[model samples]
Target: MQPADGINLHSPPPKLKFEKLSAYKKRKLSHSTVNDTSPPTYQISSRAEESDNSSVVEPDKNLMAEYVDFVKVKPTKKEEVLRILNKKDVTSPKFFQLDSITREDMSHWGLNPGIIAQLRDNIKKFEKHLTPQ
Candidate 1:
C-alpha cells in the first residue's frame, strides 16, 4: 500500500557490496591513468612530418608578480585570528589581544575598508566569548 506521502514503501532498499581488485586489474588501471607529475606531450607538425614532443610552458614573470602582489594585499585578519584562537595552549585574553593587533595590521596593509569593518565586527563577536565570566 502507498503511504500518505504517495510514495511506494514496499520496495527493498538497495544492497551495496565491496570487492577487492585483482593484482592484474589494479596494474592495468594504473597503466591507464595519466601521471600528472610529467609534462603533457603534444604532436607538433613541421613541414610534412608530425612528431610527438613534450614542452614546458613557463609562466610570464610579470604575471606571477601581479598574482603575488594581489595575494599580499588581501585581507586575512579573520583567518589569522581564528588560527591564533585554535591553538589549545593560548589563553582567551591573549588570543583577543593577538586578534586585535592582527586586525590593526591588516587595516594598514591596504585591505579594503569594507573588509576591515567586517573584521572589526567579527572581533566584537569573539570579544563577547573571551570576556571574563
Candidate 2:
C-alpha cells in the first residue's frame, strides 16, 4: 500500500522559473509589419526588354524546328511498322513472321516494355481480324 520512493506524494512539483523577455527581445520575436499601401517596386534590368524579344522569339522558332525534327524522327519507324501491318491482303502467317522481326526491331526502337507488350497485343488482334474463319 506504500509508495516505492521515500519522496512525498502530496507535495506540488517545483515551479519553473522563466526569465522575462526584454522589450527588444519581445520586438525581435514578434511578427514583422509589412507596408500594405505602396505596391512593391521591381528592379527592371536595362537589357530585359531587348533580351525578352530576342531570346524568347529565337528559342521558340528553334524549339519548333527541333520539335518538328523530333516528331518526324521518333514515330517514323513505328508508322512504317503500322503501315506494313495494315497492308491489304496480308495473311496471318505473313503477319506473324513480320511481327517476330518487328519485335526484335522494337527492342532497338527505345520503346518501353509495356508499350512493346501492348503493340504485340495489338498485332495479335490485327492478325485475328485478318484471318478468315
TM-score, prediction 2: 0.22
Residue 57 in model 1: lDDT: 28
Over 1-133, each residue of candidate 2 has an lDDT whose tens digit, in order, gives 3544534656533553557999987775452324344443344344232221222222232332232233343454555434343342222222323423465665565544544455444433443554599
Please state the error at residue 30 of candidate 1 in Å: 80
Give stretches of model 1 more than 4 Å off.
1-107, 131-133
Give each model a TM-score: 0.20, 0.22
Global lDDT scores for all candidate models: 0.41, 0.41
RMSD of 2: 25.5
lDDT of 2 at 84: 44
Q: Model 1 compared with the native: what TM-score?
A: 0.20
Q: Superposing all C-alpha atoms, what RMSD in Å does each candidate have to the true structure?
A: 21.6, 25.5
